[model samples]
Target chain A: MINPHDSVIVRTMSRMLIPLIQLFALYVLFFGQYGPGGGFVGGVMLGTSLILGILVYGRDGVPCRAARKLMHGDGVGLIIFAGVGGICLVMGGQFLNYSSLEIPLADDARRRYLGILMTQIGVAVDIAVTAISIVFSLSPINDTEDTEPSRD
Target chain B: MIFSFEIPLLILLLLTAAGAIIVKDLISAVLILGSYSFVLALVWAWLGAVDVAFVEAVVGAGLATVFFLLTLFNASPKDTEIRRQPVPFIAFLGLPMLGLLLLFAAEDLPEFSDPKSPASVHVSPEYLEQSYQKTDTENVVTSVLMDYRGFDTLIETAVIFTAGIACALLLRRDSK
Candidate 1:
């Protein structure tokens, strides 16, 4: 039932758009301090990019392997956020208290900035993975079922 | 004791909340709820709580509205009020009890963000003082949300994810 000509155009457009959206998300995450954007906004952008990819590829056209990878990535995101806090606790500070991290830089200012940046990166991954999982899981299953009436 | 613009905005917000509660149409009620959330966000911004305003805008205004709309697709429209026995006496007694509790709580609050309150004096000072130098972040709220109180933020994210998962599971169609 798939049209080869339309498929070619949609695939071409998705290939172009996905990279652009990823780059924009990275910009939002890194430049958030001086701007109105940050991890949550960046995560939503990245999530939407993947959602758009799914729309273009029509289920099977997009790799099932990638979808499985994203589900696993969701757990990784949670671990990263929790792992940083666990390290802080192990160092004798309260949970998520990054000030306790002993940096060789010998400057409190440098250490603090490093800690904040580290936590933000963790948060960015957590949000991005969670959002993508939610979107992927909620996709319209009926459409896929209808499109490929099982060969069996 | 009252300014004109502030009173109007407060009135508008209350009106939106009332409309949201009383509307017979579910979609219209959700729309009014969105309006209430937006007005509350504006009030927070006016009170100089920019971080609270941003979150209210994103979660309450955006996500709540989106969820309501998504559920609408599966929901059959119903405006008929479910008939129920009235309990005016209990409602009247409960209203005063709630008001008294609010009054007592207000008496102990920091006089609308007074600088001398323990909360304002202690936390805000350190957050404002060291946020930039420490986090290299202009947004102190971001530093606090993701760093100082990261545990609480993680729980809040989990709560949202949980709600979304629950909704999807409940709504999922079973194969025959």
Candidate 2:
């Protein structure tokens, strides 16, 4: 009862929404400073877009190269978070104290504030990548029972 | 900002939370719980804690619901009618007692957004004043999350990773 052409239309519509969702997510990420949005919101948007891409265009629609790169984004995000702290430790300040960074700032307090926001970004990216990976792994919708026979 | 809850939004939030609790179907419960989380996020937004609201919307509403749905499919959809046990009541009461203690302690908290509250007067002030200049990042929430509390943030990342792994292990099909 479903027409092939109609399916194409549906897919196209779905595809069209991806860019809009992406833009909205970015807006949330940047606007969190002044309004109601932040890294977590932005990450969800990014993850949803990828999932939407898979839904509308199927697996092939997801860019293979991007997937490969993003697969490591979680680890990279963790490294960024830890690396920031490690730098503070080496500088003989409290772990994660950005004021200790040997940067020329009028106030060390300013540097510390910047450090915190940078870390939040890393957390957001980590969340997004991990979420995407999980979605991808579980999305085939195949039942586990198919892989084995129950004797009971 | 209007502090009192609007009738419609309150009704919607109550309905969503109730639906999450009362839904007979697992998938329906997951969906309704997601709605409840979104409502909570809206509540946070109204309170002007955009950072908290964003995290709740994404993690609590989005990924958590996804995780629940995936687990839902892993098990049978049939609802089991197990009679409620009374043992949980003790723990439940203990939780509210703890909450009450915290609430009493909060009497000392700077009233809501009072500029003089310890939270408002402490390190947060520095971040508000200097984050943009030092991080060159427009978003203060982003700067704070990534740079100032980066160590704790990494631990939180590990928690998420661990949760994902735990879910996967529990949901994965066991091999003979």
Candidate 3:
């Protein structure tokens, strides 16, 4: 457990900053088609924001229910990616054949764009959740130490 | 390439690499390594590999440094002094031999941006010409990674997911 009273400045600042960081991550994920950002970069940023929150507020800062949900969501993300590929296969194309999807798009190119967008979102969600899970798994022991009475 | 700027940046990169290895403290060494990654990202950006540079900046410098710091904290009970060890004779001989071999290999490599280079002369031209038309994406890197080589990216994601699972299992075991 973290002493909520400690490091008030950092806590307040992180509270303001985490949302902004998450927004930037989403921008990176969505705008990757036209720029030097992508699922990997955006996902890492999202994870880092959560880690920053953990640093300031401790593990308990992240609600247990939320963490559990996110952990399960990692698998859901992977399934979504695979499901898209399966859809392509069922549509009489090879795996991950994005243009095969019959979206109400103007052309094959638009379908491809939408397919890529969906896949990128899945990848981003998977990576971001995995990153947070790794950080959470690693940090809990340290958190316990902080909460316990110091021997020295 | 801006020769004047590139030269100094290259020098800074070398200095950071050396500092990272030579620094006595583990924490300082990790920080210096992060700096090295940052400078390398800048160099990559300068060379117009913006996507690669972005990955380096975010993953290598940012998340990796944080992970290293966390691992360092958890692994050690206290701030243990990083002892300076004498370089082994094999390392001195082996590293230079490896470097010399690479230098010799470099002789056969085409000059940077040479049109006739194997890289530029191959599928790269086709990819550059057709990526936008085929994928409706302006970013070639994204198209290449996600569309052209989707399986590879999917596998990479699987690997990361496995790593997260492994970390969770290991850490949870320790806690219990």
CA lDDT of each prediction against the hidden true structure: 0.67, 0.67, 0.83
Interface CA RMSD, all predictions = 3.2, 4.3, 1.9
Once superposed on the true structure, which residue ranges of model 2 sit more than 4 Å away at CA?
A1-10, A26-36, A56-69, A72-74, A87-121, A137-152, B1-8, B79-111, B115-140, B169-176
- How many clashing residue pairs appear in each of the predictions shown? 0, 17, 0
lDDT of 2: 0.67
Residue-level error in angstroms, candidate 1, position A12: 17
- DockQ-superior candidate, 1 or 2: 2
lDDT, candidate 1, B1-176, per-residue tens: 54755887899998999898777667888889998999998888888776567557765775557546545644555533344467679899899999999999988777766778787886889899988887777877777777777778777656645654564465445323
Candidate 1 lDDT score relative to the true structure? 0.67
TM-score of chain A of 3: 0.84
lDDT of 2 by residue, B1-176 (tens): 35456565678899998887766666787898898899888888877876787778877887788767755554554543334455676888898999999999988766777898777787988998987777655667666766655556678888876665554455434423
Write model 3 residue lDDT over B1-176, tens digit each, in one string: 55978899999999999998888788999999999999999999988899999999999998999888887876765555677878998998899999999999999999987999888887889889998988899999998888888999888888888888898988864354
TM-score of chain B of each: 0.82, 0.74, 0.90
Tens-place lDDT per residue, model 1, A1-152, is 11123577778887898889889878877766655556666666665566556556655556333654765665455566677778778988877777776777647655556666666666666666665555444544554576577677
Off by over 4 Å in 1: A1-28, A31-37, A41-72, A86-106, A135-140, A147-152, B1-4, B76-89, B92-97, B100-108, B158-176
Which one is best on TM-score? 3
Q: What share of the true interface contacts does candidate 1 keep?
A: 0.26
Give me the displacement of residue B68 in model 1, in angstroms.
Answer: 1.7
* DockQ of all predictions against the true structure, Cα-based: 0.27, 0.32, 0.63
lDDT of 3 by residue, A1-152 (tens): 22243877887888899899989999999999999999889989988887777677654566333654677776666777788899999988889999888777448888788888888887888888888788767665453565688678
